[model samples]
Target: MRLKGNLSQIKNSRDNQNVDVELYIDKIEYITNKKDGRYTQPFEFVDELDTPLVLTGDCLARVQDKHLEEGEFAYQVYDKVEGEYVLNPDKYLELTVAYDFDADLTILTAAYYTVTVSNEEFKDIKAERSKEKKQKKGKGRKGRS
Candidate 1:
């Protein structure tokens, strides 16, 4: 499934480079047959070149949010070496009572999101950021009367 999310960060891709902006859905899973087990375990989104697609940062954060909304089940954790997303329960959230734990269990969960930007859109965002950066740099040299 193409899980849509907001963009968090991009690595390696540089200006003047024609990067193919690839996105991937590692896989999704549920515990106890929630939604009749709609997701497949270890789903792969690979290109014809065998390069696997990946999700990171905010992209993963969105996945966690989806799991919480579904049934507070598993989470998608990305493995950099494997270049895949793994569904894990260690990071899942709980809706139990406030005093159900030993006072050391963390109830506050952190989430993230990521989105793919088209090459044209990427250029636009880069240009706007460049303009803002130039303006900020110029502000440091002004003299008061």
Candidate 2:
């Protein structure tokens, strides 16, 4: 099943402690039905190079806004490792809440980036930046009025 819609930003009902942002459910492709009764959905991360990650959750969240309008869901991807969250260098998936009238829904979005350099190259780049910062610290505008 494919579902698409725009949701007004509001507070997330599943977790009321956090505020939900408005976002669009561009496309949602249903993968399979699990024996536990949850649906499997594919989520791909560009850098992982592994198969798409399957996710299942109740994306529907309650919102206070009632006016009929179209909006988008706010989302951010993170890599959780050893109980610490870090910004993923590649693509990641995040299920977000969206509301339409009295109905709640889920939206899937994919983010990606191209990295041409290797890890060693990145280290050299950082070293150059540190060197440049040191150089600039000792040099100031001599004729500043």
Runs in model 2 lying further than 4 Å from the true structure:
1-69, 92-145
lDDT of 1 by residue, 24-97 (tens): 44322122211338763332111122233444342132233453453232333333336434544233322211
Best by lDDT: 2
In model 1, how many backbone clashes occur? 9
| Residue 89 in candidate 2, Cα distance off native in Å | 4.3
The sequence of per-residue lDDT tens digits that candidate 2 reaches over residues 41-142 is 432212232233322112334333445234433333334468555544332233332444555445433322223344455455546656776777769847
Model 1 ranges off by over 4 Å:
1-111, 143-145
TM-score of each: 0.27, 0.25
Relative to the unseen true structure, what is the C-alpha lDDT of residue 68 in candidate 2, on a scale of 0 to 100? 23
| Strongest candidate by TM-score | 1
Clashing pairs in 2: 9-22, 22-72, 22-73, 23-72, 23-73, 24-72, 24-73
